[model samples]
Target: MAIGDWSSRMRGAEPCRPGTEKNKGVAVSPSPARRPSFREVFAVPEFRTLWVSYVLSAVGDRLALVALTLLVYDRSRSPFLAAVTFASGLVPYLVGGMFLSGLADRLPRRSVMVGCDLLRLLLVGAMLIPAVPLAAMIGLLYAVTLLQPPFDAARSASVREALEGERYPLAMAIMGSTTRVVLVAGSAAGGLVVALFSARPALAADAATFAVSALLIRFGVPARKAAASGEDQPSPLGQLTEGIRLVFGDPALRTLVGLGWLAAFYEVPEGIAAPYAGRLGGGAVAVGLLIAASQLGAAISTPLFTKKIGPLTRLTWMGPMAILACAILAVTVLRPNLVASMGIFALSNSFAMYQLAANTAFVERIPNEKRGQAFGLATAGLIVGQGIAFALAGAAAEVVPPSTVVALSGGIGAVIAGGLAIRWRGMSPAVGRHTARHLGREASLTGQTPIHAARSN
Candidate 1:
């Protein structure tokens, strides 16, 4: 199958083949017990390498986050500073995105991806050397973030092409789920690594992970050509605008991007929720547990939701819904205890599931050529939205009580998100059909004790 038009446009100067807004619903049943297990799917040589490289990188990312958090906390002795440092990591992602992101489509995906790994390796490696100034440290990380767009696009587009056909959706689903799960596991493991050793050691481990990921991609992934944007097209600025136009041109694309913003919108409560929890006197451990519990819900539930809710489904509604549930759950603790707060926090993870659904729909609907930039754009949107959310939530803490703020934000989210999904469903019938198919498969398979057959006739 040809890569979609929007995808084509993203690949540099070339004009891409156009795409239709065809509603391809997930078939009600996945291939049965005869179908390959998720593990088995990766056994394919290309997939094996991609999996090894990525999962390792994921672990490393988690460790680095841990290290960054600990380093800042130890230095400033201020929790807010640590949060600021973490939030800073997101800034380059937005800033560099508009300019450098086009490289994803312009270059060979394999090369771009490996370069990103190597660059990250260097950035993470530098952290292990204590002499690096904070100025330099932040600079290195910013540079590293800037380089990720092409690599991200390459990896994303590669996944779709690598398993082109029926397996594509499943592939997207698996990758999305794996990232979520690893983040959960990684966060815990990172904390442990930091506690056992120190931030320096954790960062070293992150560098090693990036190195290994580079090696895997260098040696293992089979090369494939992607659709090229015209060679004589506009300047870098022009390319970025082109990418923007291509993405928003379609209704489906517009909705998918909207979903990304929605994820950011409702996510703010959780981003600052723990700090709010801390203010309410939930100690460090309690704050950590609260955040972890929420993410855990997302890690556990999203894949199952993907299987159940197909293309037509939108999770924009759920981000707020989950936030509202979490808020309601949070408020119940007028003077909340750790366990109850943690449980409420856990419920917040449901936004993660919604994000997964949104991403899957996007991967399915958007044209492939533009996928990288589209993803970059999506990432940028999330950063922007999350920034807004973080500020709003923080301000809410100042003016309103923390719990009240969280609950109110969630309540607003629920109404807005639920309404968005309903309106989206009405506007795009394909989304509905796809969602139903995704759900049908999940429900039929969930109770069957797995290994049971689920093939189409």
Candidate 2:
């Protein structure tokens, strides 16, 4: 399928009709028919291939990171260097997302993803060599990590192209929930693998996963031309500038991105889980539980939220849910016990499932040509924001109790979320108007009523 073909069929590509009811001026989608089932989503061969490949790569990546971090600590016995080794996986995202993600738009997405996987496979295999020094290993790891953003951008854009309408969000929910579960399981599995077979085996396993993932993409996914092509295609710098403008220039897109970034606030608990658990007279096990609790709520609730809720209703609840996701974190102020603290974290994350709505809306609004760069920009900002938030929370924890720091973060997030919520409400009418006009034009071209055009598309 052509990229432009999928772009034209994007959900909400058509606008509301003149007589449709609006919720406080926000354009709501018409009542959709029966929601798509997980079985139906999985029935798409491309989706199944992409999903399995994703799972393989994600698990391998986590296991490799854990094994590598442990190897560094065991060799050097320097806690700080070990920590830095672990963090190397994350710090490159800013650079890759900002500078390299446009490759997805410039090249066929399938090519970008497969190339990344093959490159990573080579890098991980290099790490398996006995003569590779610790410093050289770290450098190779950095090189491997740098390839992730383009791969991610390509994969995400491909998924959007593969699934349409409600299937897209449902696919996202599946991936989102799977990611949380994989994080927990992969870490545990990594530790076990290292304990038995050692780090070399773990690294070898990671290299094999990348090889398999590359093969899957090469064989299973249909090839499409780059989204941005032709003589008028923008330069890389031009694409970057356009992406920044496209994401921030629109009121709805900006607000949706803001809502998604609320993670920088609600996620403060994870940053301080160790100290918080210590305060509760708990140990490493407590820290693990605290961290897992944060992910558990989302894993359990997101699928249900997407499955049962209509798209319009999901949009309607997005702001309130974001507010609650943040506000609930303030419960830490009461200094709850370990189990209670876990509950608070879990409940907060359950509400954070609102992000599924924000994500769906953001993708629906972006043109396919700009989607990779736009997603990259959003992802980079999110990573930078969370990194800063974590650093600040850690700093504040030195002066005050972790609970107090968490409460302060939550309070600040709630205030910000409230302002953004109000802004979203004010901007709804404009979105509804714009959507209506677009649908009207499409209807004229199709010789159909606006409502009929909306449904048929």
Q: Mind giving the per-residue lDDT tens digits that candidate 1 earns over 303-376?
A: 56645543323333433443354344445327466677666656665544656545555665555555666767
The candidate maximizing TM-score is 2
- State the RMSD for candidate 2: 5.0
Q: Which lDDT tens digits does candidate 2 get at residues 1-457?
A: 0001113233343432222232112323444356689999999999998999999999999899999999999999998888788787467977888778889988999999999999999999999988789999988998998898888889888998999878887888888888888888898789999999899998999999999999999999999998888888888889888888877876677788899888999999988888888888899789989989999999899999988886656776788898999999998899899889999999999988888888877776666877788778888788778878988998999999999999999999999999888887664432233556754664576564553112211
Separate clash counts for every candidate: 26, 1
In model 1, what is the error at residue 211, expressed in angstroms? Answer: 1.1
TM-score (C-alpha, index-matched) for candidate 2: 0.90
Q: Could you tell me the lDDT of residue 292 within candidate 2?
A: 95
Q: Tell me the TM-score of model 1.
A: 0.79
TM-score of each: 0.79, 0.90
Assess the local accuracy of residue 279 in candidate 1 as a C-alpha lDDT between 0 and 100.
Answer: 71
Candidate 2 overall lDDT versus native: 0.81
